[model samples]
Target: MVKVLLLITSAVLIILSLLQSGKSEGFTGAFSGSKGLDLFSNSKERGAEKVISNLTLVTGVLYFALVIIAILGQ
Candidate 1:
């Protein structure tokens, strides 16, 4: 059923998002205006980080598609 797929996709999305490593410079860095988290940095994801990031992206896309499908089916 569409509802089942929706639930699974949403859960996966949440898990994938949480599994990803933080790119931010933590709470202190935010208020301190630290340059540690350079937005234009050349950092790249490798191995599991890359995999998790990709999975998150794919799951996010799937989540949106399922949402639209559910709404349209109503």
Candidate 2:
């Protein structure tokens, strides 16, 4: 049962991770606040981006918890 859960969590994580949009700003934007770029104009992720981002974070935490449980079970 734990193995099955681990597999499902991993698959979901992979899918959610892929669905997220790539940050085009790169390292340059990290050094300086993304103020000039129109591409980075949107300070917040709206719509599907926001949903996917939240889902990814939730699934990532679930995955970590599952891994710990599985390891401790063994």
Candidate 3:
């Protein structure tokens, strides 16, 4: 059961990570100091991005906990 859960958590983590928006542009923008770039934009996550971000965090914590549990269970 633990193995099955670990597999599912990993798959979900991959999918969620893929769904998130890239932050690399911000790094480049910071170095370039682009006029239109909002490198430190104050805009809040307002929709799917917000949900996905929260879900990713929760799943990440859960994944970590599960890994510990599996290791200790053995």
Taken over the whole model, the C-alpha lDDT of each candidate is: 0.89, 0.87, 0.88
Candidate 1, pairs of clashing residues = none
Mark the 10 consecutive residues where model 1 has the least summed lDDT.
34-43
Between candidates 1 and 2, name the one with more favorable TM-score.
Answer: 1
Give the CA lDDT, 0 to 100, for residue 2 in model 3: 95
Top candidate when judged by lDDT against the true structure: 1
Better of 1 and 3 by lDDT: 1
lDDT of 1 by residue, 1-74 (tens): 99999999988888899898889878788779886567887768999999998999999988899999999999
Q: Report RMSD (Å) for each prediction in the order shown.
A: 1.6, 4.6, 3.5
Residue 39 in model 2: shift from native, Å?
Answer: 16
Q: What ranges in model 1 sit over 4 Å off?
A: 36-40
Order of candidate numbers by lDDT, starting with the best: 1, 3, 2
Instruction: Compose the digit string of candidate 3's lDDT tens values, residues 25-61.
Output: 5666667866446558775786999999999999999
| Span of 10 residues, lowest total lDDT, candidate 2 | 34-43
